[model samples]
Target: MSEAARETARFAALAEQSNVGPHTLDQLQADIRRVVTTYPSRPIEPLFHEVRELRDRAFNLLEGRQAPHHTRDLYLAAGLLCGVLANASFDLNRYHEAETQARAAFLCGELAGHNGLRAWLRGLQSLIAYWDGRPRDAVQLAHAGMEFVPENGTAHIRLASISARAWGQLGHRTEALAALRQADEHRERLTPDIEHDDPGGMMSFPLAKQHLYAGTTHLWLRDPTSLTHAKEAANQAIQLYQADPPERRRLGELALARVDLAQVHLATGDLDAAADQGHTVLGLAATRRTESIDKGLDRLARHLNEGPAATSPTAIGLREAITHHRARALPPGETT
Candidate 1:
């Protein structure tokens, strides 16, 4: 191009001011980080509304004029906010809404050219599929996430772990174990984000949650050979959860781990240990209840009935307790 044309273009670009300033972008980034870090442990209803408002604000900003870099930043924030909304909908057992939000989030990630957001959105979609009784879909989504490995994030590890659980659910033992091993390998060589502040909570897959995932996968495998592995993993998850501060502990995940531990105990004919785990899960207040946790409790109750202790008073009482516990919330909602 001629120098005259290039000069005009450069001047035009320089004259185009962004609707949002750097401080605005910084504030949006900070808010996104706060939501990402706390959503796993906080009550969902309020966070749901907060995320919705933040996402709407981002969308509105995008509607106005902005520089290319600022537009990308806004898109990234909007994408993450949409992801949190999807997660909240999933926690409330609204699968359709969750998937819809996930799709929007993925689109935002694409617009922003953010591998981390895109990969994490895929994992979130897989999780919704896994819980909504679609193991095949879950596995596919997890694989799709693998296509966009971020430079430094746990999304890839989370994808593999999610796929492992889905494979186990489908009784694909070899595939399940392979996925688990892949996740472990990723973790061993993981390069922490340069600042060591890779968003914690739901965004990053911690070791405790990985162990919990393994326990769940083993339970799905239902193989006698893997029962020992399952028990050990579940115990490790429980210990790790207890080691964290009470505020940081993911209660629903911890409860599900306990329920899986109980299942293993029941399978091994250790009725007392199973009952202890069952009681611990049931102790969680209804306000903190999650759909996954409810299903785990129901699974435990069914396991009780299937075991040799089906006719025993302790088994009967626990089964009845689960029935009542489930009744307390009917299907647990995001709002208390």
Candidate 2:
């Protein structure tokens, strides 16, 4: 080649400046997955800072020039970070903040044209609405998510399961059961494209988690007929969680499942079993605790004042223990 052509080639290769390196992007992606996967097992406070740092890094790069491919990657990573933040906020009982974060994440999904991410974000928003006592809104969000229908993975199934729970809360048995059936159909048709679900962790809806949601849905139906279904589903969820490897065990969800089982036992007038499960949930380390656990325990405490079991020492003791647990927990929406 001519000397001028060689010189031009050398300059061109040397002049490609990037705001972020490929290796940095790779490492950032790895950390995001790690945070996503480990969230159920560890405390959220420390991880909150880690996620913020990672997000800030991505956001700063986003403001600078990058190839189209790198921009998409940065947005995806940033979106996942926002999602984790949303979940953490919801766990802390900051519903408004959580919704804002989910919306931001959804925008990132749009930028990346990632249907999987968009679908999952809708599910997250639905969950927040359900917990915030807006079941009707939750159902609407789930239906909207159905429009995305990811090419692979269980995002749609997650939406259906969430819809089932929301419908149950609204006391629409027909709609709730239909949503449950839809979830089953989605699961049966799922193609396990690891690439579809993106950063998994809590984002991926596994069978065990699905069963837990089913149990909650049945419990919420408030129909005498659903009590048996609730008990069976809750027990099955517990068994599945126990079968997972230690690292993969979602202790928070397991505790929630046990609380559901306990509530079912209460509904059936089985005070002893209820008390047993209640104590087990209360024994969970602080790090593994979630907002749902506290709410479940509160429900148990209220129910304890009704039945013949109300006069029992076990019932009184459980109420006292619940009061103590709530007293010790950091108030929601606050930080240490």
Candidate 3:
């Protein structure tokens, strides 16, 4: 076949892949990666701008600046925006920001009567809460959100994943595994047709997200097997982020790097590398102020203090940096 024909065929395949159902953050990102890779010369900025505009319009409508006639479209747009922003925040280790955006999206979705979108937003919020050291809250939110959406929707999958993480944090291994099983079962039932019914806001429900969540759940459970799952998800996410523009993709890279370093250090008992990664994540957190990254850093610090890793210079440096930063941020008398 001619080169042009080959490119056309490749693009077609990517389009087909992008059509896979139950849009999740991971799925949408994977689709974006597939499209950009297949058509390297294509202008991605335009697409990003278009989606962002839609989100802005939706927010405007929600604020009553725009007529209510466009409520559905606005809700859908907000949902999509939420997914995009949440994914970006996750990539950048700004879990708190991701949670806030996701919550806003879900509220808009609820007003628009988009149950699926609301569910997805709730799941995103739950993940943020879990990462921020609020496991009980995560569990509560996930359970509550699941009631609003279909069992097989992307939202359900997210809720299940978050639930698993919360359960793991609560030291309930069996419950966490059960949630994982449910997530897997939902994945099996997914289809391309479901994408069309995605309630406008939750667009990309990719398989990589499933792996990412599974890996996270395993991490919380402190199981070695979870490392493999996380590694697979991180690799896919890293590839997708690399395929996009740097400004648009830095968050994903940070997330991939954070997870990779965390797992590796945990496995190898290398406190210094883990501490370095924690500090790197803190730098990212400075930009987004996401609670997840902050809490993760705190957790790493605590772990280092308790283990042989505490003696490492890198660990000490990270701890000092965190303390200094926190101390500087507080009022004079509030310093502890």
Candidate 4:
């Protein structure tokens, strides 16, 4: 082609590109980071709205022809928004909606060919599957994610933890333990000082979160030895969470850790301790409660009913408290 024709074509292409500048992309990224980091400290209802707004903005920017440099950034921002929507929807008891958002996030990640985003989205899908009572699917998704981030990172750690939980839920103790060990190894190699694709907050998995998963996995395994491990892990998770600053702290995680402690105490026949921990967890913000936490409490309740505590005064009081708190915690028209 002639130089003049080539110049004309280049100018036309550049003119067609949308006005999503680098500053705009950076701001969107920062907003997404804030949404993820503040997730544990706020209500899901508000976050859901915020995520939707972000998603819409991202979709708009992606509409017209975009500069090559802007394409990946737009995809990453959209993926992050979808991820936040998925998690917030799940917290609001909208399981199907959560799954839909998770799939959208996965697609965005694929478009960007972002390993970290893909891995994190897979972990989210695994979590939703686990809550929806599909342990096999959860295990598959978690393992698939692990393939993308084999080296130590938040995605690797989260995928491993979720995989361990899925294996335990499926009664595969060997695989569960292996996954847990793998998570620990990744954690050891993970440097908090380094900036990863997905930093702390919802995208990253910390040691405290790993302990919570360990506790949950042990509880699912239901072995006498496992109960001891569960109790210890739960305690460790609680301690680690408590050590964080107020803004850095996640109320939902603290509640989960407390419930895990309650479950451990109940399993060990410490009725008073179990009741206290249960009450403490129940006192946390109900609007922020996740399905996982609800499921854990359900297991604890069942344990209380089946054991000798069934007729004990402490158990009776605890049951009543749970019922009352659940009624208040869950939104109207929602059930545990």
Candidate 5:
């Protein structure tokens, strides 16, 4: 080749190498971790800006990569950003948008040869399906996620818990219990530093989150001991969340756990405790009224109306307060 052509080629190759090198990848990975850590405790709208920017940056970097290793790292970084974007969309109740982002994440995971991220993508999809009122689809997605995550880790545990939740919602008690047991078994096998590639916050399924799921599942099971088990799990989750740093604590999950406690108290005929707990939850920040927490409060309200508390003055007053809180919690343009 001519000297000028060779010089141009060398310059282009150097630029590509510098762009996709380990230092750049590491920085991108750190940025993703920051996004994940910041998401749980804040509103999705602002977080969306950061993740969207990161996704775009990743795409630009990926387009410039030539080597296989560089491509893999860039794909992983891009996949993580897409997953975060999908989660933020789900939080905003934009299920179709979330699915589109999730599909993009799945493609990145596949291209990156990262089964763990792929499994996580499925888990995110399953969560969206569950909130969309498609429990069967959630179950199927969880099963698919499990196939990608063959090891005993947080991702597998999350899939098992998702399965349990779907089964519980379907009123299949035995299946739900079995799935919970499977999750417990997997939890026992997790490595000490399981957060190796998992950036702790939303991506890693910690014990507290697992307990939250267990509590919710047991509430749906509603067997003779289910209520008691549900209360215990919810209490554990609350304790764990309370101990976390402000950034790590998931206020919405904590609120849902409180909802579980309130419902269990109501079921056990402790009207005063139930009412007080419900009042406290209603007084929480409006941002804590995530879809899951809203649904839990609805279930609590329904139970109060349909059960013996239907005519009690205390129950009636509490339920009215809850309704008002929910109305106030609606999205800005949603209030009629």
Candidate 6:
């Protein structure tokens, strides 16, 4: 099909999927995939902005705060948008923003009576908590979300991703691996129809993201298998990012920096290279609001501290940049 025709078809599919009966989540997911694949140029920012407006309108309508024509679907769309925005913030290394957006998304989903979306928002919250260095909280949240929406395929995937990371953080290698396996199993069962129904509002949860999560989890476990998974995910993400618009390139860069640093350190035991990438992460973090990226950088920093390598020039430069940024944020008396 022609590009424009294909885009139109994809969009129509998304609308149709969104209008599907509540129980037909698989069809909903298929529509989401069509939208994601067809609109690679669409940035997360504009999407979130639109979602924020829609959410406001939906809440107003629900509370008799606005026009009466608003429906539950508006609320659902808002929740989805909020979730996507939170994910975007996480991608940008803005943890605080991610947490706020995720919480808002959860609240909106709850008010909308969208249990599945609420579960997904909880998963995002768990991920943010994990990145904030609260593994136990992350685990609790993930488990709670899983319990709330046990049959939701998207929730299962989200739970698996967070569970793997949280377990790895707690040093539960077997549990982490099991969770990773569960995510893989879900992926295997996934069909194009299912992918199109993705209700996350953004297409962040692809196979590459699964691999990236698995690789990072193994990295935390200090397992040799991490290198292979990281390499593959990094390569695939790179290719996809290259094909994407400039605005979306940051996600790929962030992911690449993460896997590259991890793989390089694993291969050469080079703390300098790891620190360099960690520095890159820090730089990216300053501009974006993603807790996950910041967490990854913090992990790399810890690794560097544990190792014996002298801080490379790159590392020192990054440190200087971070120091300056922090100083700027400090009150005058606190600056010293």
> Candidate 4, residues 1-336: lDDT per residue as tens digits?
699999999999887767688788888888888888888878666567777888999999898667876888899889888888888878777888888888998899888878888889899889989888899999999989877852335788889899999999999999999999998887777675543546447887777888999998998887899989988998999999989997778778888889888877887879899999988887774646666667667777888898887999889888887777567554421211
Q: Which candidate is the best by lDDT?
A: 2
| Every model's TM-score | 0.91, 0.92, 0.61, 0.92, 0.89, 0.67
Q: Model 4 Cα displacement at 314 (Å)?
A: 1.4
RMSD of each: 3.3, 3.5, 13.8, 2.9, 3.4, 11.5
Candidate 6 on 1-336: residue-level lDDT in tens?
A: 699999999987765542324443344335434433433234334444544554454445455422222345546655665676676666555677778878877777776677677777788788778877898899889888876643334567767888898998898988988998888786677666555334432434655456556656766666567556555655565555556566545453444446455544635576555555555555554554333444454445455444545365654554455455444431111000
Provide the global lDDT of candidate 2 against the true structure. 0.86
Better of 2 and 6 by lDDT: 2
Model 5 Cα lDDT, one tens digit per residue, 1-336: 699999999998775664566677788889988888877887766678878888999999977745778888889889999898887777666677889999999999999988889999999999888878899999999999988963334898989998889888889899999999999998887776663447657887878889989998998878659999999998999999899998668887788888888988988889888888788777653765556666777888999998786899999998998788777643421100
Per-model tally of clashing residue pairs: 0, 0, 10, 0, 0, 21
Worst 10 residues of 3 by lDDT: 327-336
lDDT of each: 0.85, 0.86, 0.60, 0.82, 0.83, 0.59
Clashing pairs in 4: none
Kindly report which residue stretches of model 2 are placed more than 4 angstroms away from their true locations once superposed: 1-15, 192-196, 331-336
Evaluated against the true structure, the overall lDDT of model 3 is 0.60
- State candidate 2's TM-score: 0.92
- Show the colliding residue pairs in model 5: none
How are the candidates ranked when ordered by lDDT, highest leading? 2, 1, 5, 4, 3, 6
